[model samples]
Target: MKPSVSRSESSARCPRCGNAFDCAMHGQPFDCWCREMPPLPADRLDSSGRCLCPECLAAEIARVAQGRPRGA
Candidate 1:
């Protein structure tokens, strides 16, 4: 089953560590932890409509930027 969305604000979960938190709580700009890192594809949204966390998103960005192939 999908998790219910909260009305407080949007948050992100680390794909690597499975840590869930708000970007603002982490002193970030966007509503997700990935705010401090980089932008993602238009399809990265979760069922509840939230972005991935910074660490997970950053790693993906870095891997792509480095041309290290996908899913690195």
Candidate 2:
């Protein structure tokens, strides 16, 4: 498995775009905005095992629905 990007508590830089964004995945509540998003497809994961920022995630979802892969 690939190592994940380093992240501070409640803060992370999106591994894909290097955009700094607030992340609550490991926070007290454990509820995060990503929970509301559709699960990304396994093939689309790129096996990076890291999270994307809001804009990148949204764009990825759209790309998948349109039968396009990342960087296409």
Candidate 3:
């Protein structure tokens, strides 16, 4: 079953690391912290299409920007 997020929630579990973190996107994508960062490519998304925490997201962006392959 899928996890349920409350409309007023401000945090979420990171799909990549299973860590609970503050997620501005929990209730507001447009104002999320991720909005200020580079967007993750389609191939980097988890199978469930959930957003990653800032740490994982930044790592992915760095990996791609530095010409490293996914998971490398």
Candidate 4:
């Protein structure tokens, strides 16, 4: 049988910025810090389903906000 690999202690490269950040949900989704944050918009997602680091996520949010109508 193949050994189970745990990503709980691993780091992933942010698809947006390429920075490596520790992922709380790598193998523990329910215990991840990201579970508490608002979901990212569809437009922010790329072909990859990888998670973005806090900084990149924030930048993406800001970019979206800037492109929206003032009253939106």
Best by TM-score: 2
**Candidate-wise lDDT, in order:** 0.54, 0.78, 0.75, 0.63
- Tens-digit lDDT track for model 1 on 1-72? 233254335465544466764556444443433444666554443456544556566776777668675565
Clash number for candidate 4: 0
TM for candidate 4 is: 0.61
Please provide, for model 3 over 1-72, each residue's C-alpha lDDT reduced to its tens digit, 9 standing for 90 to 100. Answer: 244454335778877776666776546435788889987778877788687877888999999999899878
Alpha carbon deviation, residue 29, candidate 4 (Å): 4.4
Model 3 poorest 10 in a row by lDDT:
1-10
Name the lDDT value of residue 29 in candidate 3: 38
List the pairs of residues colliding in candidate 2: none
- The pairs that clash in candidate 1 are none
Cα-based lDDT at residue 29, candidate 4: 48
What is the TM-score of each predicted model, taking all chains together? 0.46, 0.74, 0.73, 0.61
lDDT computed for candidate 1: 0.54
Please identify model 2 stretches exceeding 4 Å from their true place.
1-8
Error of 2 at 68 (Å): 0.4
Model 1, residue 12: C-alpha shift (Å):
3.9
- Against the true structure, candidate 3 has what lDDT? 0.75
Which digits, one per residue and each the tens of the lDDT, describe model 2 over residues 1-72?
Answer: 233466667777777778777778778888889889987888877576677888789889999889896756
Best-to-worst TM-score order: 2, 3, 4, 1
Best by lDDT: 2
In angstroms, give how far residue 31 of model 1 lies from its true place.
Answer: 5.5
